[model samples]
Target: MASARKRKAAAQAAAQGAGGGVLAVKARYDAAGSGRRMRGWNPPTSGPNRAITGLQKIRDRARDAGRNDWSGESSTQHWTTNLIGIGIVPRLRRIKSKNRKQELNDLWDAWVSQADADGVLNFYGLQTLAVRSWLESGEVFARLRPRQIDAPLAVPLQVQLIEADFVPLLDADYWPGMPAGNTIRQGIERNKYGRRVAYWMYRDHPGDGQLSSAIDASRLLRVPADQVLHMFEPKRPGQLRGVSSLAPILARLRNVADFDDNVLERQKLANLFTVFITRTMPGGVDGDFDPLTNLPVDWGNDGLPLAGLEPGMSQELDPGQDVKFSAPPDAGTAYPDYMRTQHLGTAAGQGLPYELFSGDIKEVSDRTLRVIINEFRRFAEQRQWQIVIPMLCQPIRDAWVDAGVLSGAISVEEANDAKRVEWAPHGWQYIHPVQDVQGKKLEVDAGFRSRSSVIAERGDDPEQVDAERAADKERDEELGLFTAPIQPDPNRSDGDSSGESSPGRRPDSNKAKK
Candidate 1:
């Protein structure tokens, strides 16, 4: 019975010990599970546990700062900062800074450099160097250094000559008091007064002077002397003995029988004279005559020689007859018959017949003489050619280049290189050589700008300048910047999954998204 009791107590103790060990193991498992659940439920608070919490705080701050909105305001800023941290932004910034510095330095250097080795800072020099650099480097910024030497563009002197001639007709020996039947002889003497009086009447009557003299001067001047030509009329009885008084009276008559015939003859004579005179004059061309013909022919189609005048030609006398004159159509309205009646009116202190004769003759004669004088003046002015000396400088070259006025380029080593080898504005083809102070040969480059080089060397920034210019253009546009609509690209795909829908096509539904 004692053995049985001891065994039973030991068995009880073993069962209790096994049960306790099992319970302890179960508690440990439950505690571990609870701790793990708690750990996952609430993030770590401190130490190594605080790492994830700190990251969460950072993310929260970023969200509050609007970094979470991809298409919102802060998106670009956020991306930029992130990119900068990765090193791209810093490198870009550095590159931009380097470029700006280099550009500035180049501009500064150009400004300091002398335009010419001679130390002359002419506008042409500045422009040439600037343009050259721009063409070579594609930059337009250049600065001009102040030149110590003062050089002004030289202005050439202009010279002209004018000539006037005085020819006296009668010598003292031909005085009216001399002899008898000589009176008839004296009246026909061709003196200065007779010629002058003849001209006066021709202007009024259009038929005076030896057809040859009238034609010669007309052809030389390239004008119609017929307008001033006068026909010879017999002088009235009791007229002054002086050639001037009587010659004028005779010139006034429109009734002179051969007036029209004389005009026709004079026209023929004038034309021949034009050809001869033009051939003798330098720079003379047919066009230099009258703007009408522009031909080198004389006034009259008739080939009259210039050498037919006798020495003693005086005014003649005959009985005067009743005269009537007609005025041209364009005569002013204020003067109904002024050109005809008044101009051809009777001479003062002369009879009715003499008066009518004097008026018509003098009027025609004066008109022709005036026309001749004017035509001569015109020819003289047109016969001149302007001579200009060009300086081989940068600014001048640039100006010519920019304007596209230069025709061709020649090297200094070439013959007559310094000359302006170009066609005239009127299309005259000619080449002019440039000469030095000592008349030595100088090489001239034909393609030159009078002003462009100067403008380029003045230190203008082409790109920035262009950009500003573009901005100005934009500002001047009719549409304001914000009001302008966006243009859609034709190649873009619409937001559709169907392959049939082209990127550029718009959706059929026009409704806005909900």
Candidate 2:
């Protein structure tokens, strides 16, 4: 087969007309006894000229017939026939194999490089390429997608630092009454809330990190620890209070336009607060009264033994010396033996004063008042307590009202009385008539009453009743439910046996015979 194909190819390439055979010749014969007109040529008998003319005529006729046939045929059939005549069939070849993978890679590279050169980053293209590469290579792309590359990831450092510094200060200052043990936790909670507020403020206003931090600190200081925890627990997205509510307040404090600032500020602040609060409290105040101090303490040691005398005890024995013990113990002396002994005594005394000889209760009260005032001053300086207390207290008052602790326009006693009355059933009375009317009852005949008393008393006539019954019987017969009395068939028909016959049909002939 290979050799035959080679030979055929060579022959065709040589171009001596496809097949090796010579062309066929046309057959003709000379006729004798021709009409005599001129000497050599016979006068117009059917000669080669006539024969050529006849052949030309036949060729013209055939061409005209083909044209007519083509015109008569449908356009689709004619096109198909023309295609066949031109040997167009059996010439179609399938497309050659393509390097689709390389082509795709080249297209992708061209788009990416063009974008990179123009400084116009194509995020979608980059993402697609990364995903495609991962799918093809079974490995995640080492390079970042456009979105990942462009996205701001780290929280702002300044915001975080501000939260760290300001929140603790706020807790120390504004919440002076809060025990030291709980301070860290409270501060952390407040920090979280304040950071949210600050985020709202600085989201649009950049570069005021100091002011924003201060506002956050102030808010943190002002927010009660309990309230902060309730609002920020579970630390997931969308857990924060409505931005609409928090944003305006934060914006006013930060002196900014709106709350569309960088989210990193908020996120960093949140994370910082979370970490700060989750950690052990400093100063041994852990939201519970310390058994030793009978004062709020944190999770830290504070140099005071758990079973020792109250914290802040002095070595001086005289009552006057108690006044001299106002300051915290000097550096290394904070946990002195005398202070520890006093702390143990205080703890044993159930937080009562161990000795009246040490100092007057009035003096202690005075010292506490001073500490509170100084803390307030610190808070004010830090700008953490800028909000008026009365305004902040409004929500608590509203909460009380909502919880039904207070009534609207009524005393508590009166409201209680109203509620009781509403729950009691009303309309609990009954009565009966003392007398009844009597008369001769009019008789109804077959549910129809007569206009004349005598006619109604007489009742219906017998003849009319019989006629009505007959008419009812006829109506029932017309409705096909009853039949008039019929004479028996002489043939004693057993009725039609075929189920196709209706009740109205006459008996079948076979039945009549039976």
Error of 1 at 17 (Å): 99
Worst window of 10 by summed lDDT in candidate 2: 155-164
Q: In candidate 2, how many Å is residue 321 off? A: 99
lDDT of 1 by residue, 1-514 (tens): 9999999999999999999987876877553454655566553444321232222233223333233222111222322222122111000112234554344334223432323424554333343333222211112222112222232211111111101001111123233333322211111222333322211111221223334323222222211111111111113332211111122222333333244345556666555432121123335333433212233435444764223223574423223312223332332364435434533342231222222223234444544644543443343223212101111122222322222212222222321212222211111111122322112111112234322232222223334455686676576443433222224334456664342333432333222221
Model 2 lDDT vs. the true structure? 0.29
The superposed Cα distance between candidate 2 and the true structure at residue 441, in angstroms, equals: 49
The count of backbone overlaps in candidate 2 is 27
Candidate 1 regions exceeding 4 Å error are 1-99, 102-106, 109-113, 119-488, 493-514
Regions of candidate 2 where Cα sits further than 4 Å from its true position: 1-177, 186-220, 225-229, 232-514
> What's each prediction's TM-score?
0.14, 0.13
* Model 1: lDDT of residue 264: 51
lDDT at residue 220 of model 1 (Cα atoms): 23
